[model samples]
Target: MIFLSMLRLMVHDGFSLTDATPYRHLVSGLQYLSLTCPDISFTVKKLSQFMHSPSKTHCQALKRLLHYLKCTISFGPHLCRHPSHHLYAFFDADWAGDRDDRKSKTGYVVYLGGNLIS
Candidate 1:
């Protein structure tokens, strides 16, 4: 159940599906879940990109994601107490990670009082 990362090697060369299992809906629901489950945010973002033209491979990746979520349904974030009122944040980016558009992949997590706020 430890989906350390959802860095799938997806591409835009796959065959499109006509009756994809309502991928847009499923991914949108997952998007809502990612609000609390920060771990799945990146994967959901990746999946959401195919809403316009999803393929069979995308569906498989989504099934794996759903399976991981079901297995980790009981897990939650762990927040520890701190002595100071300082805000801590960390971010990372992969510059030009997207081969299609040369867009960067960036994400950040904001913590307040040892709690993740974003």
Candidate 2:
């Protein structure tokens, strides 16, 4: 599953990633893309975890993301002017989900007029 891979990517530095790259631009660029493409937001967030020490594997992931973006250029969430009347926010927290750092994991999803806005 992609979720497992995302977690795996962060847990252990890729052994195959011997060649590190200065990839701030690529990572930041993909981060900007997350604004329009929510689908890649999680992956971009995962990639950001290693901004200080990006590896060759990270660069490859960035390249793959760029290719995916190019292929689905038209796919992006839209904010309708005539949005529904209701706006709401919901969130969840898992206390210390990561065993390594004991960092609590939190997540949220906001909706406007029953449409997922976050």
Candidate 3:
């Protein structure tokens, strides 16, 4: 689920709209998956935005995300038995990254003893 940094999904991409039921259903499941799959949290968050009116492009992105999940099904955070005392935090933000709303998007991850905690 490596989205292009320059990729910008809009509410209206000139593509035909699709049924929202499946999209909403899948996105909802992905929200739960994001709890363990931090790698997909940002992608799931982005896709969740269009659950109300998913277009063809949005559906395609969702499908790609599904495929990515299928391919990485075995990947997830693993807790260490002998956890270290060190704590680290990393974050990134895009200034006005949302093309539809011109809002900033920021994300952060916290790690304790080399294991993701947030």
TM-score, per-candidate, Cα-based: 0.58, 0.53, 0.62
Alpha-carbon RMSD, each predicted model: 6.9, 6.4, 6.8
CA displacement after TM-score superposition, residue 57 of candidate 2 (Å): 1.2
Candidate 3 Cα outliers beyond 4 Å, as residue runs: 5-7, 77-118
Each prediction's number of clashing residue pairs: 0, 0, 0
Candidate 3: the clashing residue pairs are: none
Candidate 2 weakest lDDT stretch, 10 residues: 11-20
Question: Which candidate, 1 or 3, has the higher lDDT?
Answer: 3
Candidate that scores best on TM-score: 3
Between which residue pairs do clashes occur in model 2?
A: none
Instruction: Write model 3 residue lDDT over 8-32, tens digit each, in one string.
Output: 9888855766457888888999999
lDDT of 3 at 12: 82
Model 2, residue 83: C-alpha shift (Å): 15
Q: If the candidates were sorted by their lDDT against the true structure, best first, what order would they fall in?
A: 3, 1, 2
Error of 2 at 93 (Å): 18
